[model samples]
Target: MFNIYKEMWDRRKMIHALSLQEIKKEYAGTVLGSVWGLVNPLMRIAVYWFVFSIGTRADNPVGGAPYAAWLAIGMVAWFLLNDAFRLSQKAFRSKRSIIKNTPFPIAILPAVQITFSFYTHLILLVVILIAMAFALQTVSVYWLQILYYDFAALMLLLGLGSVTAPLVAISKDFGRFLDTVLIFLFWMTPILWPVENAGPLENVVKLNPFHYIVQGYRDSIFYHSGFWEHPLYTLYFWALVLVLFILGNYLYKRMKPIFLDIM
Candidate 1:
């Protein structure tokens, strides 16, 4: 873990540059270009707002804030995480030329995707905050805690990406499997639905690591609650992150040698 992270830290500048290059490459030919990053998610949010808020007639406020405001915060976290996970899995496959020819630090490949997603995440966050200022009409110090949740989300992505990227390289089928899992995770995560008084099912849902993050975003934005207020959940989230980080590094090291052969 130390070695992989140390190398990534040493090559942070390269990672940053590659991440930017990736963002540009992704939208290179589009008329709107990078604007699509913000536009795409905003469109999704509009669709969800229409569906749930209108179609389903579930217009109830969540945590004393408009449902749109609450939903935006959760979606902000999800967009970053989901994009990072999906893109990082392609890190090895996508950068085949670099891997074949350059002495690049493969470990940092996942970080590049995470950073790329993070750029858009920050933009969405700012837009959400502005929307909240108008919608919620108040702000709290707890809003700053979003920085903590963002870090937590990034760490979670790094750990999971490290493990999955190599596995996806080994078998493209794993990438498909990951897609199914992400769909399940999105529904189970309570992003679109309220889990209030969900009984024992709430316990099961919270076991999904993302539940901590989605709820944490709400806590930061709507509930005005500090993360420390939930001590056990906090500990559990970090413990899971630590285990994944360790295991991801272990798998990454074991599989990296075969990546070129498989690709």
Candidate 2:
């Protein structure tokens, strides 16, 4: 464990370069260049907004805030977390050759993918901020609360990601399972439909442990409330995130030796 940490620290630059390489390669040979990352997510959000917010009788009216802005807050966070989760799972798959040959820490692979998604998410966030400033009239220092929103989500990702490492490495089927589970979770989460009161699902969602991570994001970014405003939710979320992180670290360390062998 100590050695892995030391290796990661020693190879920080290499990891960052790999992350940049991934982003560039993903957009390489395309005429639009880096613009494709921004454009692709924007298009997806547009289609989602068109279908759910416009086509259906969903209830996401924000009183004065436009539906687009409301949707951006949630979608941006969702995009960040979703992309990180999906891409990180494939980190080992893509770098299988390196893992097979090198003495490098396997941890760097997932970290690299997460960093790549973070870069793209940052670009989308800038676009969202500009859109909100011009269209929604809701851009202000109060919006800095989004920092906490992002922090909480990253914590959840780190915790969830650590746990997924062994699972994904040992079983390629976990990626398919991950996609299916995320799709199911998308419906369970109130991404399109706004929650009026917590409802029956709210109790179930609260127990989900990730529910507050998403809700806290929407609350902080769109609703412009400090997470401390919901002290109970704040405490509950970090508690779950921390516990999972510890357990994930333990499981990964215990299973990692056999993991590479099996892979």
- What TM-score do all the candidates reach, one by one? 0.96, 0.90
* Top-scoring candidate (lDDT): 1
C-alpha lDDT values of all predictions: 0.86, 0.75
- The deviation in Å at residue 96 for candidate 1 is 1.8
lDDT of 2 by residue, 1-263 (tens): 33433555687798789889989999899999989888988998889888877688453566445677777677877888888888877677767888899886787777788878888888998888787778865556667777777777766776677778678888889878998988987776766656545577666666655566566666655566777787887888889887867777776788788778887
Residue 182, candidate 2: Cα error in Å is 0.6
**Where does candidate 2 have its weakest 10-residue lDDT segment?**
1-10
What lDDT is reached at residue 6 by model 1? 76
Error of 1 at 262 (Å): 1.6
Residue-level lDDT of model 1, residues 129-178, one tens digit each, is: 88888877888888999999999999989888887889998888888999
